[model samples]
Target: MQIAKVRGTVVSTHKEASLRGAKLLLLQYIDEEGRLLPKYEVAADQVGAGVEEWVLVTRGSAARQVEGNQTRPLDALVVAIIDTVSIDNRVLYSKKDQDRK
Candidate 1:
């Protein structure tokens, strides 16, 4: 899994039948310092994360391991909405802090 920020939504008018009703989101990968990386991903949202939210994303076969998603054509999936990210007790990002800004 990697840390990523939700950039926006990806609407698909036509998709595989197995992917029906899935929420697709555009995500920009972020580094350990919270800097955005050039790489981006379109992941199926399993956590209902909104734009700008920091999320935990799992790619490849790990994404298909989730219940009810095993047959979906999902290469990536949003697994968690992060509340805080810390390293050595130094908080790098906090949802509460972001909300206050």
Candidate 2:
């Protein structure tokens, strides 16, 4: 699992049958300090995350499993809303910061 910032939402009229009714969100991989990391990709939303939300994402087979399906074509999934993130006892990102920004 990794942390990412939700960039936006994806709308698809056509997709795998298993993916129907699933929310797709664009996620930007980020560092511990909450800076954007190198890669960005779309993910299935299992936890109802919204745009610009900092989310915890699971990857690979684990991601698909979290959605309660094993055969779905998914590489990532937003599993949680991060309330706070700390590094070296320093707060990096938090819901409070989001509210302030």
Candidate 3:
């Protein structure tokens, strides 16, 4: 799994039947220090993560392991909504802090 931030939502008028009800979100890869990378991807939301929230992303075949995504044509999936991220015993990000801004 990798860390990323939800940047936006994706809406498609036409999609595969298996992905009909899935929510697709745009995400930007973030490093351990919480800096955004240039890479971006669209992922199927499995945990209902919202925009600006930090999320855990699973890619490739691993993304297909999520319960409802098994048969869907998904290469990435948001598996968790992160509340806080800590590294080297330091807190890099916290949802509460983001909410205050």
lDDT for 59 in candidate 3 is 91
Clashing pairs in 2: none
Worst 10 residues of 3 by lDDT: 61-70
- Candidate 3 matches the true fold with a TM-score of 0.90
- Residue runs of model 2 more than 4 Å from their true location after superposition: none
lDDT scores of the candidates, listed in order: 0.93, 0.85, 0.90
Query: Which of the numbered candidates is closest to the native, going by highest lDDT?
Result: 1
- Point out the worst 10-residue segment of candidate 1 by lDDT: 12-21
lDDT of 3: 0.90
Candidate 2 versus the native: TM-score? 0.87
How many clashes (backbone N, Cα, C below 3 Å) per candidate?
Answer: 0, 0, 0
Per-residue CA lDDT of candidate 3, range 23-88, in tens? 899999999878999999999998888888999999999889967788999999988999898888
Q: lDDT rank, highest first?
A: 1, 3, 2
Candidate 1 structure quality by residue, lDDT tens digits, 1-101: 99999999889888899988888999999999889999999999998899899999999998898888999978999999999999999999999999788
Best by TM-score: 1
Q: How would you order the candidates by TM-score, starting with the best?
A: 1, 3, 2
